[model samples]
Target: MKIVILGGLGNLGSQLAQTLERDHELSVFDRVDFDVLDENALLNILKDIRPDILINCVAYNAVDNCEDKKLYETALALNCELPARLAQLALQFNFLLIHYSTDYVFNGLETKKEFSENDTPNPINKYGESKFLGEREILKQAENGLKYYLIRTSKLFGPQGGSPQAKPSFFDIMFKLSQDNKELTVVNEELSCFTYTPDLAAATARLISSKAVYGIYHLINEGAVTWYEGALELFQLLKQKVAVRPIRSEDLTRPARRPKFSVLQNNKVKKLRPYQEALREYLNNL
Candidate 1:
């Protein structure tokens, strides 16, 4: 299979390219080499390559910053418009479209019930709204005979990507803070599962290779945890003796409203290994 990965230098995209390069003809595009949003360049590349699969890993994920009107526009353009455009191309070129969505799409109100792929999205924050709109755009294309797999996952962490704007994962940030600061505070709220990029990339390959029936799927690492709990586990794994203070979500003023419990349930496919296992592997590698 000939695969083209947009935003290929970013965290998830980098892992996906690495995972698939040996098995498939892989073409990767990063912002450094080419502006992925440049319609003309992208169209020409697609025309020349006519890839069997086009994977979009670009997203505007500055959650709090997205509350600013200007950033929100950028977010919508990247998160929604870009995917919409790719979905159109997927239909026209007859290729499989693989786009990633987020767990933030849920309201987080259904704490007792985990969110399944079948659940309707009701995003509560600007960032979540933008991602949900992206999902809607792809769904519209699917209605128009677009073959696609909408994978919704959350709390991605692992090796850093080449994107300058790519922020380090929560684990990295917390670890860094621990190094410099005597005390570290992490939010003990907003529960969600963590995803390892390599694990996700591997699962994506299996899903595609198996020719699995897909509509919307959740490919997240198993288990749910609050940011504070996650931080504790992370510190424990590193065997770092740092004081981790628990903080409430309301204690800090943020631009975006986060879901209290947006744990995604993967009832559609095989469950991923627990995040603890993935996190250990990541730490060992580093």
Candidate 2:
């Protein structure tokens, strides 16, 4: 299969590229080569490549920064308008569209209840709202005969780093802090799965190949943990004696509101390994 991955230089995108390149023809488009906001470029690329699958990892994911009114236009363009346009192209070209969304679509009001694919989206912040809108656009296209898969994931982490486009994952930050012998401060109030990108990318390949029934699927590593706990586990894995301080979400004072508990229940697909096992594998590889 000929596959084109947008934002292919980023964390998850890079992993997808690496995973699928072995078995399929892959073309990766990053921000340097292709901008999601540039509709003409996007359209031309799609028309030229006409790939069997177009996996979009592109997103305006600076959570708190997305709340800024100044960034609203860019956010809407990348998070909503771009996907909608891609959906239109998918309809025209008849290619499978696989888009990544977030667990943030949920309000996180009910701490005890794990959100499933069937749960109604009630985004609490602009970032979540934008992602939810993206999902809606793709689903709308699916309704109109576009083959689409919306994978809602949370707390994505991976081992790939060092490139200018490579932003460190949460685990990376903790690992670096531990190396520096610096104390870590993490929010304990929020709970979500720490999905490993390699695992997600592998599962995605399987799902696409299997031709699974799809609309919205929660594709995340099994089990949930607070940020503080995740950090402690990282420290333990490293055998680093760095002190980790737990703080409430409110104490951080971020611009965007976060879901207190955005753990997604994987009902549709269940191929991913547990978060702890994934983390250990990543660490061992590193």
Candidate 3:
């Protein structure tokens, strides 16, 4: 199958492109090459490419910065607006549309149960609201009896196609601080799943190959832990001794609000294999 992945050069998009390339003809379009903000240009590019699958992976992931109205507007364009337009094109052209979403759509107020597709979304920040808008657009506009596999994931990490400008990941910064023997403080309060890019790619490939089960699906690696635990694990993996401190979210100052417990339940995804097991495997690869 000919596949076109938007944000193909991004962390998760690049990883997915590389993995999918072995079995399918692939073309990746990143922000530098094809900006989603330019809808006409995007449609032109898509027409030229005419891929069987158009994967929308580009997103404005700057959680904190998106709080600015201008930034939030741009985020909405990248996350929701363009995706809706692209979905319309997919319907017109009869191509499968695979879009990525976030686990942030839900506020962390649910005390007992894990978040599922059916839960009501109450985003706490602009980022989450934008993502939810994208999901809503897809559901509203999908056509051709199309197969729209909307994969909702979280805290994605990978080696290549990482954030440019040396903007360190939670793990990246922690590793750097540990290397310098600097004590690191992480949030022990907020909770969610850590998804490795390659693991997510593999699971997505499996889903694409198997059933035509469409609609929304939560695809995250197993286990829910706080940022503090994730930092400790990284240090332990590196065989480095770094003093790590755990604190609450209120301990830090940030522009955007974070979900308190946005851990995704893989009960449906676990029918394949728990993402936790996949996460351990991915860590071992590093």
Best by TM-score: 1
Model 2 ranges off by over 4 Å:
161-163
lDDT of 1 by residue, 1-286 (tens): 9999988989999899889998999999888877777889989999999999999999999999999999999999999999999999998899999999999999897565899999999999999999999999999988888889999999999899887877799999998898899998889999999999999999999999999885899999998999999999999999989998999999999989999999999997789999999999999999
Give every collision pair in model 1.
none
Put the candidates in TM-score order, highest first. 1, 2, 3
lDDT of 1: 0.93
Q: Which ten-residue region of model 3 has the weakest summed lDDT?
A: 270-279
- Model-by-model lDDT, in order? 0.93, 0.88, 0.80
In angstroms, give how far residue 130 of model 3 lies from its true place. Answer: 0.8
For candidate 3, lDDT tens digit of each residue in 155-239?
8775657436223457766766777666888899778888877878888888777765787888877778889988878767667
Question: Model 1: how far is 280 from its true place, Å?
Answer: 0.6
Cα lDDT tens digits for candidate 2, 75-103: 88899998999999989988999999999
- Candidate 2, RMSD to the unseen true structure: 1.4
Q: Please identify which of the two predictions, 1 or 3, would achieve the higher lDDT against the true structure.
A: 1
Taking all chains together, the TM-score of candidate 1 against the true structure is 0.98
Please state the error at residue 244 of candidate 3 in Å.
0.8
RMSD (Cα, Å) for all candidates, in order, is: 0.9, 1.4, 2.2
Worst 10 residues of 2 by lDDT: 158-167
Q: What is the lDDT of residue 163 in candidate 1?
A: 79
